[model samples]
Target: MSTPSPNTEQMTSQPAILDQTIGSRLKETVGQHPDRLAVKSTTLRLTYRELDEQSDALAAALQALGIQAGDRVACSLGTSIAHLLVIYACFKSGAILTSLNPSYTSQQVVSALRHVDVRCYIASSDILLPYKAPVSSSTLLKSVFAACDQDDGQVSVSSVIVVSNGAPNEQAIQDSRVWAFEGLLEAHRGRVVEPATKLHQDDTISLQFTSGTTSLPKAVALDHWSILNNANVVSHLWETTCEDVFVCTVPLYHTTGITALVLAAMLHGACLSMPCEAFNAQQMLRAVVEDRCTILHGVPTMFQAFVRLRYSPEFAAHDFSHIRTGFIGAAPIVSSLREKLNQQLNLSGIGNAYGMTETCPAVAVSTRKDPDEQKFYSVGRPIPHATVRIAARDDPHQTLNVGERGEVLVAGMLMKEYWGDPERTAAAITTTVSDDGIKTRWMHTGDEGVLDMQGFLTVTGRIKDIIIRGGENIYPPEVENVLMQCPGIESVAVVGIDDEAYGEVVGAFIVLTIGTVISLIEDTKSDCIDLRQTTGLQTANDASGSVVLTAAKAREWVRTRLSHHLVPKYIFLVDELPTTPTGKIEKHKLRTQGCAALAITGAIASER
Candidate 1:
């Protein structure tokens, strides 16, 4: 048995109740809830004791494979028990975990592997064509840990660790590196996994890739302190408690899911439930109702689907009485969607959160008690320990006043640098000296927003997404949110195009709900106009005689709701809008397509 280390002095300046290394804190949770269910899937349910024991065994196995501190281990596994084990093992071994999206094509996978130059891979056997480093040939790789077959007890490469409920791939499982992980667990002596050195608060723990608007992907490095601090901030801000049950259906590779849902659950001892498969609205609703989930964390798109599902009569029959709170982040939510959810689903409140992968995914978040106007207009104030300000690019000393838009600046509880990209790191942070010579620097958020007199931040739009409508400063997301409220519209994307009168005008592409018609015809002439029959016009057009529903109809719907100047001038029907790999609607690409379509139609205004 490993001897327990003596308690060390706490970092008085840092947040309390959270360890710099979550691995240690996780182990403590295991001790507290040894018999409680820690993970559950369709075919698996693991208690905390079993989870801890398995993690120890996996850590030992990794050590045997020559994995050590600072080593980069990449995983492209499914949402299974084994995948979680791999992540925990990496944590225990002090190795940085780089998560790869399983749906990525091989070329993309190759590019990521090359970018990170991973030292080892723990992948699922079912996913053929394992990820490879970009180098022409491998070097310094001790072995491959896979759920396939293992040949003899070879000391090095090409070894697989077959993992299945039933028959195993004996051939792939026989390699030296392909030791049976479960078998190793049976042999373990219940000793704690020991680390060569203690993990520092500043040491990198994980590298998450964020897709840039243009350039290649950036590896967002998050350290132990940043993660722990942000988790504390979010859990405290949302009032997550031990009694809360969080429904986490977003992919674990996504930043929001990892930092917000999974980590927060662990921090607060909240129960977490998510299926092995990707998110399905119907399945999620059923699970939430059955599990009595108290909290839900997801993107805006996911909630829109859930709202539509709730509109069905069949959905009203379920028992959703237990849901109390929900947090939506990583995307903008339309006010119409929020209102619909509140009216239909009984969701307690909707929080609009803003952050990036590098910041542990939370800087600002909304609350339930705020007035409807503030909730609709701005993301709430900065969470604890975060300092937010807006500064002009040309004059950092000139802090913008309330309602004046500028670059968002953040400091405290932020990452110190990006891994292996000093140039980008220097570009991201600014250093200044205080009167006493203490260095003060803040991170440039690359987003533009306005702060109200009360300090609430309203993100007008991304710096790159702003449209200078003859220097009027039009934000497409603000317009898109209004356009999405149109009665017949199912989805919308707004962008700006060049114009002579105005430097740019907003154009929207809309996807209408199925079964909408452009024209409604009636046989009034044959029926002698039936003026007497249609005398009660109020009841005659209950819903059937509504105006023809088209993209133009959608435009008219918004025309009545928003200012004439704010309404989009053109609306086009599209079966689908271009989306980013992470499922966000790609506005720039749609803008290009929209401009081309308008040009062909001769809708472009002549030089006037």
Candidate 2:
């Protein structure tokens, strides 16, 4: 067994928690800066007053349609000004908002709605058309005037609100159950709903489904208190203000896009700048220059893509100096990529925000004020009002000392519960009494991490992700972080492959930098089993397909770095690493695909 490192029970700096609903926050912002730009999109720019009145109209219309407080309001509309308005409408009408991925197919969308027990659904024509059209014409042969066909009863949806993308407002759906978003708003123009006083602060206001990195996505129900406060803390950490412009590169449906950026912007009265309906590097870069966007946000992959596009001739003339900082989340940021963003893009004070959806999302955030050593290595101290403690992996009651790795237990501003799944919710949350006799409900974050003496948290990896090779617990991130420093390696994921003798062994999936021309894996008894990949392999086409690094040299690089048991037994070269829709590396998928690939190549699954 590996020697256990120490950790700490140091609580984060607690600040006074704000008591306000989403609607109240919007109302406050409107009062403070009614004429300020609320959202800047390619087609339209909405002022705070315009947004407040417009969203109020939609909320009034929703109430007229019998959508009451606590009702679930679902939207699969792609990123647009209309989507933003819908979000505010849900907040004002006291309906539970769950913004879904617009790219989901009819079945996937239907399944999600059923899961959330949706009452109202707002969808773009792009997704609804597939379900409404015949299988021969579209992808699915489907039904409730294609999904909101309430009589069909697949979901408990009462109304289907159609949002035409850049098209004229018309009855996109012929069913009486359907209504155009523009038409509904027009009818209820100059109207406003009553304050959200009927809803309590702790009442559930939103349902955020987990990205299902390892399994199925669970709907996490967040309350007004947690969601609003989480956004407030993050907005404060980012130093967002009414004059700031935040670029929303990721989908607003996800917590990263919604809580970290969208809600943060709204809470602080900052302008949310949408360069395009979807992420486009060129357009995003142009927005920074044209719109003078001050804040930027993206996953590691998006930043990687940005690095590649930064120097392209089309964007060479554009200036990124206007970008004050950026937020990188969903995955670990490569030191190389982080540096490039800072030096080339002039985003010198980039902050790293870390939290899962269940935690109201901002448990810890690194800020510009932090020293480079602390900010870069750790994901900042826990955000205000977030209490973090490291507990023994085997025993939740045993708190670890500083530097020890264990399950990260978090409290304060957490989700109300996993929607409708009491069993799982109880299993995830545990009531713990401290030595002082104070009782706190701690969320057992499956994430494994360590807190330093100074309280800076460095997330190691997930507890399930720890590879037990020969009874030795090996963290994949430890190996992956080291491999990131190796020559020509761009991105890497480490997984535990099944082994009979040792029980399991480390395996790595590597993506090489584009134009890299080196091959390390050799066909030998002690090395990879007949990779069929020769030396001097190169990829001038794309970064995903690049095959520059080899196994022989890679093994040599690994030999001196990590523990002998930690060295990967197998290394596979791939064009691109598989990721979830939210851009997190799917390690579970990696293990399956890697094993399948070996089986296909007639390799003894285990012998290297």
Candidate 3:
């Protein structure tokens, strides 16, 4: 349904929204701040002028390699300065850029590239190892490497360009069809390459694949109007400026890294700095202090990694005083983890943000100006020019009142389409015309949430993740929040386990904190079971190899805080939660694992 026709304030004051494309706007930043540091990695740094000229050289080389406007140029790269250069080159040359994670299996990479019919494939030789493995090693390697990815008619990749990390990769890249990245730059440098003369705001600039937790990932095509403007507006809202050194840990391939960190930095002339090519929690924090980085953004796991190491000898007395503001997102953040980050780290300006990959990743964010309580728990207000509301779970036309739990509906900053999949796109976005003749398209976010009277949005859980226990509905986060309050528990995931008597029951997977002990001192009258008795543990694989806590104590903790039905009937202490390539927890996998672990009989299921 169309949004309750945006009020006059939202309709009239969209001056924050820019009409220009990123390629042209970034050049303006070069002229405005020529000497400012633009992009930085541990080994490399480039000023705005240097970045502009280098991207220009790469743009010429890309066009020389037969890349045309609207052609898909795929880069199997990770978060590196070279990847950042390729981003600008594709933008400047008018080619639609597609980033593939280097760590993915060759089949996964080929499937995504073939889905878009990528015309030019660029990657470092190190990133090509997966594609060049022996025929017996990979299912898709029998055809060829980076060529003939799809069938005869479906494969459109014409050429492959190989980049070097720091040394010669010509020997590593022995393919006859490969072009050296250094050779192309030497030949094309100093050549003038003009931006696409007819670029439109609606033209797709970046094609990205979602993390696909429960199903196959979809390729999302994003336009300049939605992505670039969203970045610009958020930069303005975050008050990022040339003086800011924005240290980041999120992978550049994800939408949050590109739009919120990279594009935002370039648009505002802020220096986008990284600790290193690969993720290291300690190294990332060291960069924040050593480089005096003012802003840092990352997924929950990145922060969780640091929290796990915060008490080490090197990190115990570490200083985060130089850091001013940051963000926690891309996963559900329980209050326990939030409090650990807030109290132990002594970080003051950390806030929360919410959105999906399809929303170009930023719809609502809590700024530093927001109250610490609101910033910690809520995802703050709808971003500038974006409309957010809660609609009845089953009926999109029925808007729920403030504070009522429902599905979240967002109106702006959405992707153009699930590239080439109109049916899926139509299913995701709904269009309706208002009585005044204004047409607005709203995306149906499968997340359950509520907007408070102050306009702050608190995400509850995914609609698909709700557990039906007997006749009562239970949100996993509601139960998980209570479990996090348990003293020895570190992290938790709640899933619905199949039960013959109750249809479904709650099951929990827990990871304990360091040095935690599950004591039965209170149960002195009870006999202790043998250590070899793992059947009662209900474990799938105790990656820790030892269970420190008992299921009874963990279940008792939840039962005291939440409803009896909401208490977990089965609890498994896993070493770690299964996650997507991005940091989102995969609950569907947990459901399968939980089903296998649940050996509960009718007597156990009927327990009080």
lDDT for each residue of candidate 1 in 459-564, tens digit (9 for 90 to 100): 8777877777767777777677777766666787777876779878777776656544332232121111111221222222344755335444555666786766
Q: With candidate 1 superimposed using the best TM-score fit, by how many Å does residue 392's alpha carbon deviate from the native?
A: 1.5
Give Cα distance to truth, residue 48, candidate 3, Å. Answer: 0.6
lDDT of 3 by residue, 1-608 (tens): 43232221232234367888888888899999999889888778899998888888999988887788899998876577778888888887789999777666777777776789888887665542211332122233323364574346576777788676644433453455568777887898787687546777788989888744447778888888888888887777677889988876887777888888889899888998766666767778777777788887877777888787788887788767666776788877877778887788766677788888889888787877778888667877787788887888888877787668899999888988888888888988888788999988889889988887667888888887888878778889878888988877878889888878888888887777765544444332112221213233233244254445656777788878877898887666667788765678889988886665444333355583
Candidate 2 ranges with C-alpha deviation above 4 Å: 1-15, 127-154, 166-173, 195-197, 211-214, 317-319, 434-437, 517-521, 524-548, 603-608
Worst 10 residues of 3 by lDDT: 524-533
Q: What is the lDDT of every predicted structure here?
A: 0.65, 0.76, 0.75
Give the Cα-based TM-score of candidate 3 against the true structure: 0.88
Query: Which prediction has more favorable lDDT, 1 or 2?
Result: 2
User: For each predicted model, how many residue pairs clash, with residues at least 3 apart or on different chains?
Assistant: 11, 18, 0
- Write candidate 2's Cα lDDT for 341-436 as tens digits: 777777667777678888988788777677776655677778777878889988988878777888999998788888888998898898987699
Q: Which pairs clash in model 3? A: none
